[model samples]
Target: MLIKNYRTQFTEELTSIFDEKEIESFFYIILEAFHELKRVDLVLNPNLELDTIQLLQWETVLSQLKEQKPIQYILGETEFFGLPFYVNENTLIPRPETEELVEWIIEDLKIKKFKDLKILDIGTGSGCIAITLAKNLPNASVFAIDVSEKALVTAKKNAELNEVKVTFIEKNILETEDLNQQFDIIVSNPPYVRNLEKQEIHKNVLEYEPHLALFVEDNDALLFYRKITELATKNLSKNGQLYFEINQYLGKEMVELLEKYNFENIELKKDIYGNDRMIRCVLKS
Candidate 1:
């Protein structure tokens, strides 16, 4: 069967479960992953055919899509910060918002003229942020810690894929008793989503994505933020900077938490959607 024909059928089948935009995105992602074809390829060569084996593979992926599995997991890899990263059920899929967090870090480093900077990424799922920074800032020493050994394995694979050296450790952020060496920068996109908001999330995420990397008790939504901030105040180098991708609903509270810890230059920035999504603060020496 022709690739174009299968895409149309796949889109129709997915439309029942996902919205028009999501279905379209899914179609494009699958095409790229399975056939090495882009949407433009389909447009230019509408009659391009898929062999029987390819068709069966496409059908299997389509079935998973119907079941609301994430395309990143389906492909077992994704692009983040212009680098390819391996992902799975063990790791949280890197998001564009987190990419923005990486950009902020790079920009700040450029302005500081700081080299050989020691940096730490808390809960570094897939090691996207740490690896990206290590790749972009060659002189920087990057370290990442996550509770899940499986996630750390995926992160290690990503670092190797990007050909960047990063130190990956298996440690629970909430229970971390010490980080012996101080760091010039600390960054995290820790679980800030309140459990009560689960219903608002799409089935594809709530059902398939790892909840251990996604949720917090509604009553303790700032749990990770509190723990990381406390550690940063003690373990960050003189004038070290801390960054976070935060829940929009609790931006003010997040800022206040940092302020109480005496972090200076606390700034809250919005994402493309104009929701408060990022925070950066400097820890005084």
Candidate 2:
């Protein structure tokens, strides 16, 4: 069948499940992933045909998409901070808000002129934040930890895929007593979504993404943050800074949480949507 014909049918079928813009994006993203075809290629070659094998592949993806599966997981890869990452059920697909957290850290490093700094990423799903930081901040020693062995495996694979050296460790942040070594920076985009908030999450996310990485108990919404903060007090070097990509609705509580630990320069910054989504704290020497 001609590619354009399949594209038209694909859009019409998915319009009910997803909006027009998202359906269009899924169409082209699949084309690029499966056939090295871009939007321009489709425009230039309007009559391009899809062979039987290719059609079968796309049919499978279409079935999954109809079931509310996320396109990122269906594709088994995603882009973050302009770098490619491998993702799956084992890892949460990197979110744009988390990308913003990475940017804040990178910008801070550029301003400080810091080098050879030791950095740790807590619960580093897919190793997106840790790997990106390692790639961008060449002089920084990056390490990542996660409780899920399956997730760590994916994260390790991502580190190698991105050609960044990050030490991947399998450890539960909540159960850990301490990080034996000091780090110039410690950052976590940990589980901050409360169980009650699941209704607020998209069906694609709630159904396809790993809940271990996405959720927290409503009674203890800051459990991971509190644990990481405690660990940072012992693990953070003099004048070290900590960063968090927090739950948007809990910004005020996050401020109070950091202040309880005496984290100085506690700044709550909004993401592109102006939701309070990122926080930075420093411990002075």
Candidate 3:
């Protein structure tokens, strides 16, 4: 079938679930993943046709999309910080907001003259943050911890794919009483979405994404943040920095929690959306 015709059929099938813009985006993503035909290729060569086997594969992908499966999971991989990562139901798919958090850390490191820096990434699903740090800052020692062994396996595979070394260990952050070594930088994109907000999430996410990595109780929304901050006070190197990708709704609360621990230079920054999406704090030297 011609690319144009297939797109029309795909769009019509998905129109009920997703709008025109979303369907278009999904179409190009799947086309590139399955056929290596990019959006530009489709525009320039509108007559490009899928062979019999290719048509079968395209139809299979379409079926999954119709069922509201995430395009990333269907492709089984995604790009983050210019590196490819394998993703599955065991992990939360890396989001662009998290990419901003990673960029913030990299930029901060560039300004600091510290050498041989040690970094820790808590709840390192898919190892996106830890692997990106190791890949970007070649001299840094990176360690990541996750509660799920299955998630850690996926994270380790991503590290291998990116060709960067990161130490991965399994530990529940809530139960983590000690971190033996001090880190020059500690960062986390912990589960900050409250259970009450689940109604606001799209069905695709609530159904396909791992809830263990995305939610906390509405009454105690800052559970992970409090735990990580407490540990940072004890384990963070003097003058070390702490970073978090936080819920925009609780920016003030997050900053207050850090301040209660005597974290200095606490700054809450907005993401591209102008919502409070990230925070940075420094430990007293």
- How does each model score on lDDT? 0.90, 0.92, 0.92
TM-score-based ranking: 2, 3, 1
Each candidate's clash count: 0, 0, 0
| True lDDT of residue 192, candidate 2 | 91
| Residues 202-240, model 3: lDDT tens digits | 988999999999999999999999999999999998789
Estimate, for each residue in 1-285, the C-alpha lDDT of model 2 and write its tens digit: 998999889988898889889999999999999999899988998999999999999999999999999999999999999999999998999989999999999999988855569999999989999999999998899999999999999898988898989999999888899889999999999999998888889999998899999998999999999999989989998889999999999999999988888788999999999999999999755
Q: How far is candidate 2 from the true structure (C-alpha RMSD, Å)?
A: 0.9
Per-residue lDDT of 1-285 in model 1, one digit per residue for the tens? 977778779888888788899888887887888778898888899998989998988889889988889889988988998899999999988999889989999998999966569999999989999999999999999999999999998999988889999999989888886788899999999998898888889887888889999999999999999999989988998888999999989998998999999999999999878989999999865
Instruction: Evaluate model 3: give its lDDT.
Output: 0.92
Clashing pairs in 3: none
Candidate 1 local lDDT, residue 26: 80
Off by more than 4 A, model 2: none
Candidate 2 local distance difference test against the native? 0.92
Off by over 4 Å in 3: none
RMSD of 3: 1.1
